[model samples]
Target: MPSVDPAASSMYTNQAYNTTRTTDATSMDKNGFLRMLTAQMSNQDPTSGQDPNQYFQTISMMTEVEQMTNVATSQTAQLSRQKDTNAQAMLGHQVSYITQDPTTGASSTATGTVASVQFDDTKGPSLTMADGKTLVDPDSVTSIQ
Candidate 1:
């Protein structure tokens, strides 16, 4: 009986998986670029140093990344504050909301005045019913009076 070699089969599979593959560029933040620059400086050949233009280009990229990060952070905080203001207006208003139990697949609707609002990093804003039940989905409000 003839035997199949495991090493030969593995080589064939690897070649099939890697065939015709083109490398895609991965995104790097400012910190990653800085680390890369540090490594490049430390490893450069003493006879011929790295180009000054490349160093300046890396600094420019880092500055742009920092500015973009600051803008994104400011915009996020502004949106959060707007949501909180809107939710605050719901307090003391009679509202109806729907809730579903995940395990039982049962649903129910409750009516009450909004007792308070809850805030977290992830959710937009949660509403606490007068009965103490909290609703996370703001759109689930069926009626607001």
Candidate 2:
């Protein structure tokens, strides 16, 4: 029978494996925890066996961790949506953005008509300029016109 070391199994199963670097929500889920628990149960030593109390404690801890992660993810998504909504409110208003001319290499400020506003999955808001250029916050915007 295959035996699993709880500590090693837990470490491998609970490892942070987020695909998106900007947020932790990408990898945080209940399935991973459940898989870890299953592995622990399957690999437990048969002679001594696993302690029921310890197993219950581990399950409880996993539940709490999963709940906490869900809460954090929800909060982050809410905050991001709020920020995007706030940015969308600026639509139709003329905004100034710092754009560099490809040829000139000098930073020139441009005030373009706000064509539209968009939000990415990770980033909050992106403003579409009348000239067809999309600008993201901090890097693309200089001031709101």
Instruction: Give the RMSD in angstroms, all C-alphas superposed, for model 1.
Output: 17.4
Candidate achieving the largest lDDT: 1
> Candidate 2, TM-score vs. the true structure?
0.56
Q: List the residue pairs that clash in candidate 2.
A: 4-43, 95-145
Which tens-of-lDDT digit does each residue in 95-144 have in candidate 1?
A: 88788999998989877889887764445577888878666466688888
Instruction: Estimate the TM-score of every prediction.
Output: 0.60, 0.56
107 in model 1: Cα distance from truth in Å? 6.2
Query: Against the hidden true structure, what lDDT does model 2 obtain?
Result: 0.66
* lDDT digits (tens) for residues 1-145 of candidate 2: 8999854442211112345446376564567778877987889778987878998998898889878977887776676656666667767777777877789798877787777766544454677766776664634666765
Error of 1 at 4 (Å): 72
TM-score of 1: 0.60
lDDT of 2 at 114: 72
Best by TM-score: 1
